[model samples]
Target: MKPITALFAATLLASATAAVADDNLEKLGQFKTTGASPEIPTIPQTGPKADAIKKTLAKIKLPSGFKISLYALVPDARHMAVGPQGVVTFVGTRKNKVYAVTDRAKSGVADDVKPFASTIDLSIPNGPCFSKDGFLYIVEQNRVLVYPAAEFFYESPDVVAVPIVPKGELIPKDEESYNHTARVCRVGPDDKLYITLGQPFNVPAPEKLELYKKWGIGGIIRMDRDGKNREVFVNGIRNSVGMDFNPKDKSLWFTDNQVDGMGDKIPPGELNRATEAGQNFGFPWYGGGKVRTNEYKSETPPANVVFPQVEMDAHAADLGMVFYTGKKFPKKYQGAIFSAQHGSWNRTDPVGARVMVTYLKEDGTADKTETFAEGWLTSDGEYLGRPVDVAMLRDGSLLVSDDFAGALYRISYEGH
Candidate 1:
């Protein structure tokens, strides 16, 4: 498990970019890609930057008996996937790097943070998810790559990388977007890989809606582990950066960022539930809740367009979420949904640089939503740190990523 040489890194990148579809993962899994040479760079665990990030956390507010601490210094940390063994956490970014943050000593705070597979050319590698069986899947702008046994072997530079969806195949290259291109994924209860594809435009032209629907853009799609049997799971979503499966019914729940430019107060954000495949969640026809987007207001929305289960305040820019399945939290917090509000960028008065918790009723539907953590926004409308995603560690402690801060914060509960 030695580090790869600079020559090997460059060669591997070329091969991966040129003929990624021809990769023989089964053969590569046999340690055929091993090499020895330069080690990847690791972010400093303690430095001025880390200390600066900690000072900002002092302003963060959580419920009683809870504490927040700096977990890792991950650059552009967007969504996160905790390893099955709790040995490592693969964090995705809106840029080209996928970081591996490790708490190898089980010290509660991460001691090591470094780029995973630093040689590979990653494009907006914003979604990293793990299956229970030890595979790490990273969904990029137009490709999906999986690393076998990623949790245990990510330290090695030559760890096997396999493509689930080859380059430029996740979506049409012509429709690729810089905005709304940050994807998120999860391994579902049924062992399928679910990914969200955000449609590029603020609101697409009416003529392109049908094409977007057909291509699964601005929606969620599912496929087998090997990237076979791919199909659109849900449609009519504008831009969903986060999703997760409910432990209760195994149904899919997600947060969608509604269309902009429809005024600051109209058309609230959405949290939706998809009980079955091929369901539409109401996009262009109804922007958010029953508020219709002006672009397609005159047109008739598809029949049976399912609306949001909970309509949040407009322009909160809701992103990643996870279900609470850990035991360390109190019973009241168990089974609740924890989500991140990335906050609004263009609103005259900013809102939602916080973490949210949604409680569910006995019937498994959302009962109510409330703020769980706040103070990322200052009184003067300046953002101290914009929360991006929330993930659960094996110990039931919560890890929240902030791209604005380039760091991760850990929240643990200790009863009085």
Candidate 2:
């Protein structure tokens, strides 16, 4: 990828564990520790609801039998994750902060959005989620921090990590690295872990570049809790801010951000299915694999990798997706995918900033997509908040984390 400006290409932060062994194909990233203490950065206050929050969500349209509510309004809530125990946690890093919200209170709204743990300077976030044991994990620009959910909350706000980037895998000093962290993470059905690290930039590193040839830096990778046996699960993903696996088939899925300026609709974001172990979806070279307007289409074209299973609009910025395993909706939604469209600015009128439900065929292909939840994006371009992540409770109610609103919204089917 071409080198960007200093601000956009901020200094590479600390790289936690990447699936690499420094073999012939490994150039692990290392974040040189700085002499700075982590202080709670000022949380970006929502200020106050400029208008009734409903006015923001009012224009959104959705399928029948679905309803949305203003769960709670907090601050800059970024990403979120839910554990088997029903405890939910999320991160917002405009000022390097983290929070935990729980449904245990029974109101189905986030009562308290409190700090889980954080650092003094990191501004980016990897989103948050957990393993079955109630261990919580949050990611900053360069590191993925893990903490026990129960221990971190109620008992103590301090989070003790299970593991961070191991000692030897740091990126060599003089190499170009993207460290585009903050890719979403989820636990696959096989009881293993999977996470996304975005493309270094919109394009792949120039050919024959040592760093690119070494460990594949700009794509998604899978690993175990020990951070061992790491491997690139997919490639050509410019960014996958939102992701989740199908609970039914155990297939890997993610939403890759679109390549910018490709018009308003051509290179839509991607909803991909990692069919095989080593699939490479087309990126930089004709996103969504369509052979139009995408300039790189003429490039040699990758022969080995699978394209996305579904295509969303350009700059839709689909951030989080979860398969509906709950019985709350019609039986047809048994395994559908609900994606949160964070919305976009570079576009003319705005495309995302709502939840989309992609209808899934038995074979795992997405046949149709619909608006499951609306109101985040406005027709006039004003938004109350951006929904970042989606998770289903044990009772099948759905929880959506709104970074713009700084609260968690729960959607449950009350009608019989």
Candidate 3:
């Protein structure tokens, strides 16, 4: 062979090999770097302790005509997604398991709680969302998977999950971290899948800001369910574990956990509204709303940075949220937003550990914020149950998942 032709052939071979290696890494995920695949531990199926649940229920405080009851005993429940049929409620966890809380009796309460996708291995499988057409989407630490006919097929032992975003492609391998690893997903009315990517750092270094922006980390990204045409929907958010679309205006709303270590009450948690794409909610620059952090004090934030609609109490780790669209609740709560304050861990006096309601004005702007439910945090700074997510059942009742108590509670209302 001629010398030039031989050289060209060698270069082509090397290029092909590199492409193949990249493909393998994408398919294998973090196991490529760690050399060991993490296994999902076998979780025992057990109901919540009846006496303990009764004690917790007695401690719960709700508005007049409202009552809270044990719905299921799902361990490590973080985020929840109710199926279209309302027969199955999917619960996600920060751990390796996802649970299906089934209401077999068609009653408001769930009768059975079982592990979902038990055959497939997962990492930080904390976000479970459903499309209007009944597709169940699960977002893990590094990938997205969808289960078709999920409500029906969940009963089977081996349900196949179709990969929408292949493993290791959601975020760069170097950016992954154990902290803020939990992701939340929602299907918008525009027929797109939205996923939140919380940057690993509490206050990211200035040097890493551009890369985080380019990769859509520390913000919400939206794409087709097939994982194409992805774009950052909101930016400059610091670890938002929950989000939901307003049924009225179809705008995206989310709960963001602000910066810590700047004293307990300096920067508050945020409930923000994103009216359009490409909106930047001030993050490292302004930790919550207007409170600037020391790390980014030297840098100037974007001129048009958006602020939160409601600034919640500091250290109140806000998580999953949903707009109240059910009819069972009174007319007052028709368009209100219900979000879970997972409670704070960094304060001398613990706060939150309750469900909060944010009322909206006629113009679709936030009007006022109030505590919808409390009693999770004891007087002595101990938490009986930490609410992680708030989901609505078909009967207009709300289901609150508690990771601390390893159970789900249903809050319903009867006329006074």
Candidate 4:
């Protein structure tokens, strides 16, 4: 699938989300960074980016009282993680460096972006998870690498271990079949490492969709921390670039990408709970609560096959998810899920590209979804940036990274 051109997103955001949405976009002090901003107002302040930054920030729409502040300027920053103290780890495309940014809460915004490890580059590195035991694990296209939490910011990286593909499963081989963003390998409740393997190919051709469906081309895989005892945890799942372990019951949950070219308003993306190992969720069949055309004779999955609990807009590319366990926000935000939608390239309505909050039920299911942060999509659908992941600060505020902008933003509330 081609990257959603900025030109197409402009039209989609207008007729699609504008009519059905309720939240407002927010405007922080914007910089005249090079991007789209034709519909925004003029910035009032004067500085290096007085015009562009103020204008972009002013045009932002959010949920009333919340405001955003630019945190740090990164060059090609991707997924990130917060370590002990205020240490922040970021994956930068510039010279393939994994940088660490640290600051004390009392010090506030003065915290500078620190360099954790460099002198090497990893291929499209995705997920960066910190183990409770003080180790940082990041996944590369070919394998998963673990590093000492202490050595992350000060010294060169030392590869601790690398996980291998399962015995019978069709994990990606050498350079011949390098998958994009193998994503993060998380430590499940049982201390097992759960790695999300995305689909190697795009929507299967009509004649081959059914054949690949049973082959389990895309889904979740679990293994020991040292890369042993691998098993297929679930099947019938399209690409799940973002996934996490539900803290309440230790169940696995993930957001799946829906196939495109099936036309608008059908076969939407999904937010699913992997209730049990080996459970099957509809993939090539039903998506985002809507049915799509398939060559399969039945097209519909068996009743026993579980569908998503909450379906998202088709192609809304939900990435990086974490449950709110900190006390920085109001009590209402506790135990909820915060996910970053990288935005959509295929949909007629340019959905996602912002961070969203889905309040979980007492039983740990999504009760309602709310916009935690906005500004990724334009009223006319032009994309200013795409949020890749959300890292929670110890103080309860959130640190969001935009790969497009190569920058980080912090969102913290002032009053109750």
Q: Count the backbone clashes (under 3 Å) in each candidate.
A: 0, 18, 0, 19
lDDT tens digits by residue: candidate 4, 182-214? 465677788877767666555444564454444
TM-score per candidate:
0.93, 0.80, 0.89, 0.77
lDDT over C-alpha atoms for residue 163 of model 3: 77
Q: What residue runs in model 3 are displaced by over 4 Å at the alpha carbon?
A: 1-48
Over 1-416, each residue of candidate 2 has an lDDT whose tens digit, in order, gives 45676544454323321121121011111222222244433333244572366555555465656666656554666666665666554544444556655545866665555555432223355466677777665554545545655433432332344445332242233332444556566766665566676655555545623354244444676677656676667766677777777776777888877777767776777888876676777665666546333456556767865767777877878888888888867787778898888888788868777888898887878889888887776668877678777877777877777777665666777556
Per-residue lDDT of 1-416 in model 1, one digit per residue for the tens? Answer: 33568778888887776464244343455556534344878998888998888888888888999999999888999999999988999999989899999998888899899988765668899999999998999999999999988887787766788888988898988888778999999999999999999998887888887778887997999999999999999999999999999998999999999988888886899999999999998888888899988888899889999999889989999999999999999888999999999999888888999999999999999999999999999999999889999999999999999999899999999885
- Window of ten residues with lowest summed lDDT in model 1: 18-27
Worst 10-residue stretch by lDDT in candidate 2? Answer: 20-29
Model 2 / residue 349 / CA error / Å: 3.3
lDDT ranking from best candidate downward? 1, 3, 4, 2
Model 1 stretches with alpha carbons more than 4 Å out = 1-31, 34-38
RMSD per prediction, one decimal? 5.2, 7.6, 8.7, 13.0
How well does model 4 score by local distance difference test? 0.63
lDDT score, candidate 1, position 269 = 93
lDDT per residue for candidate 3 within 265-307, as digits (tens), equals 8698999999999899988899888999898888888989999
Number of backbone clashes in candidate 3: 0
